[model samples]
Target: MIIHTDRDLSLSGMETFTPKTFNIPELVGIGAKNIEEHLKLYKGYVSNSNLIINKIKEYEKDPVENVYVLGELHRRFSFEFDGMRNHEYYFESLSDGKKEINKDGELYKKIEIEWGSFENWLTQYKAIAMTRGIGWVILYHDKQTGHLLNQWIDEQHLGHLTGLSPVLCLDMWEHAYVYDYPTSEKKKYVEAFFENLNWDKVENNY
Candidate 1:
C-alpha cells in the first residue's frame, strides 16, 4: 500500500479556505429558498475542507501511528475540496443574472467546431445533465487536447477529468432542485439553469 506524505497531499502549510459569497438574484423556476439552502451547503464544504486539513496536520505528529487515519483523511479531502470548487463554478455562473452566450466568441466557436453547432451542443449537454444519479454535469476544457468535453461527475469528485479546466458546471443533486421541482421534473431545472446562466462568466472561464 502506498502511504501519502504531506507532499503528496500538497495541503501542508496552506491557509484555510474561506467560503465565497455570491450575489444571486431571484431566478426563474428556481426559487430563492433553494439558493439560500444551497449556499449553506457550500459553506459546509468550505468548513469541512479547512477542518480536514487541520486534522491532517495534527495527525502528522506521528506518521507511523497515524498512517491509517491519514490515509482516510487524504481520501476525504478531495470530496470536500471538489465540493467547494464545484459549487463556486455553479453559483458564479448564475451571478449578475442571465446573459446570452456570445455567438461570435471563442467559446461558441469552439463548441461549434466540436459539435457542429451550438444548438446541437446544448441538446447533448442537457441530456448529460439528466443522467441518472445525484451529481454534477460539467463542461470542461482540456488544455492538453485544446478541446471541450462534457462529463458526469458522481457526487463531488468521482469521474473528474484530470488536468481539465471546468467552464460550466450544473449541480444535479437533489438539493439543487428539490425546493423548486420534484425529482421527475429535474429536466425543467436543467432548462432553468441555461435560461439563467451568465455566459460571459462561462466564456471568461475558458
Candidate 2:
C-alpha cells in the first residue's frame, strides 16, 4: 500500500489538473488498445507496483503509513471515457534550411508555432524516445499558448507534460505491446501505431 501527496501528482509546478475537469481520454485505437492489453496482462499488479513508487516519490516526508488494497473497481481499462480520444497529426516537412508556406495544415501550423520547425521538433522527440526506460515519450502542447514540451514517464502514472498541456503522447512502455510483438521489433510497433490513431480527438483537444 502506498500514498501520494497532491504535490507529487502535480508535476513540478503544473497544478492545473483537477479531477472534475481533467478527464483521461477513452483508451481507443491501437495505442489505446495496447495500453489496455498491457494493463490486463499485468492484472492490477502494475497499479500496485506504481502505488509503492508513488508513495516513495510523494509521501516520504509525511511519516504516516497508509495501506490500500486496490480492488477490482480501480481496474484500469483502455482509455475509454467521454472526452478521451486518440490524437491526429498532419504531415509537415522536416527538411532543414527553408521556411515554406503554411499549406493550411492544422498540425503543421501548430508544430511550426510550438517547435520552430518540424525537423527540430522531431529530432528532439527521437532523442527523448531512446533515452530511458519503457513508458512514453510525449510532445505535450500548451492549449492556451500552443507551446511544445517534450517529456517522458514511467507508467502513465508518473510523467507530466510540464509547462504545456499534453498534445501528443507515444507509449514506449514495454507492456504496451511488447508481449505480442517482440521487444527487438520496435519498428513494426511504430508502423502498426498508425492503425489505431484517432486524430479527431487530438484536434478537438487543441
Candidate 3:
C-alpha cells in the first residue's frame, strides 16, 4: 500500500487519500484477527485506488491508443473508491472504543420520526443486514427530505441511492465475520457489532 500522510501531495498537487488508521478497541464477538485482516482489505482498496489513478494518467498520455484501457480503468475506479470509503465508515463507527448513543441527538430524533421509534429502526436495519448477498447495509440521510432511510447496497459501487449521505455502514460480506462467526449465524455478528458500536461516531456522521 502507498503509506503516506495526508500532507503527501499527488502529481496534481492535490491531496490523495491514503489508507486511514482507525483507533478500534476490543469488541464483543469480532476478533482482533478479523479486524486485522479486514484492515488489510481496506488498504488494498486504497492501494488500488491510487494505482488506478496513476495508470489513468499513464494511459491518457496516448488517449487515442489506450482509449479502451482508460475507459475500463475509469469504470473500475468507483468500485475501488467506494470500497475504500465504505470501509472507512464501517471501521470508524467501531473505532475509538465504544460510545453510547445520545438519545437527544438529531440522529436519534430523526429515527424516531422516520420509524416511530429507535427500536423499530434498529429492528428493520438489522433485518436488512441479513440480506442474502456480499455487500453493505447502509443508513442514509436523504438529503432532500432530511429523512433517514435504510438501503442494501449490492456491492461497493452498486445500488447507491443518489444524493443521499450515508450515516452508518455495516459490511455484510462474509469476510466481515467468516473467521469468528459461521455464515448461518451471521446475525450474531451483526448483534455483536452493535454491542460494540460507537454511536457517537454515527452521530457525527449524521
Candidate 4:
C-alpha cells in the first residue's frame, strides 16, 4: 500500500517478494475507492505468496508426513505469485496519468504488424477481455518467435503462454470493476481502462 512511482518488483529467493507500490492517480472511470481496495487485494497476494513459500520450506523438513500439504502449497504458489505480478502490470499501466500510445513506438509497430492495424488489435483484445470468466486479458511478447500474442489468463495463473513476457495486462475479474460498474456494464470499465492507460509504461514493458 505504499504508492510510489517506481514499477520494478523485488523478488528475493522463494519467500521474499515485496509488493510494488504504484503511483496511480485518480483514474477516468475507475474511482479512487476501487483502486484503494484493489491495492489491498494485491497486497494479499504478495503476502500469501510469501506465506506459501515459507510453509513449503517448513513442510520440507518432514517430507513424507507433509508431502500432501507440500504438494498443495506448491500448486497454490503460482496462483499467488501470478496474482501479485499481474496486478503489478495492471496497476503500473494506469500509473503516471494517461498517455496515448506513441504511433512511432516499437510496441505500436508490433501491434500493427501482428494485427494489421492498431484498431484491429484493440478490437480483438477488448473482445478477449469480455470472455466469460474471472481472469486477465494479456498482450504478451513471445521472445522465441519475436512476435506479440494476445492471451486470456484464467484465474491469474492458468492459460498463460509459457516463455512469453506480458506487455500489457487488463484485469477482467469482477473485483476489478464491480465497485464502479455492474457486470452488465463491464465494457464501459474496459473503455475507461484504455482511456486511463499510461502507454509509456506499457511500451517500456515491451
When superposed on Cα atoms, how far off is each prediction in RMSD? 3.6, 11.0, 4.5, 6.2
Could you give the candidate ranking by TM-score, starting with the highest?
1, 4, 3, 2
TM-score on alpha carbons, each prediction: 0.94, 0.49, 0.92, 0.93
Error of 2 at 152 (Å): 1.7
Over all chains combined, what TM-score does candidate 4 have? 0.93
Query: Which residue runs of candidate 3 sit more than 4 Å off their true CA positions?
Result: 1-15
For residue 90, model 1's alpha carbon misses the true position, in angstroms, by 0.3
For candidate 1, write residues 1-206 as lDDT tens digits.
33446454545455579899888988998999999999999999999999998898788777889999999999998999999999999999999989999999999999999999999999989999988998999999999999999999999999999999999999999999999999999999999998899999999999
What value of lDDT does candidate 1 attain over all alpha carbons? 0.92
**Candidate achieving higher TM-score, 2 or 4:** 4
CA lDDT of each prediction against the hidden true structure? 0.92, 0.46, 0.90, 0.91
User: What's the count of clashing pairs in each model shown?
Assistant: 0, 12, 0, 0
Runs with alpha carbons beyond 4 Å of true place in candidate 1: 1-13
For residues 1-206, could you state the per-residue lDDT of candidate 2 as single tens digits? Answer: 23336454423421221222122233222345554454454434434444443444454344344213222212232222111211112111111112333436686677777779877776687667665576666667776765657877655545454466555566665665565467776645554443444454444445
**Candidate 3, position 104, lDDT:** 86
Candidate 3 residue lDDT tens string, 1-206: 44335322232532357889999998889999999999999999999998988887678677889989988998998899999999999999999988889998888998999999999999999999989989999999987988889999988989999999999999999999999998999999999999999999999998
Error of 2 at 54 (Å): 17
Q: Please give the lDDT score at residue 176 for candidate 3.
A: 92
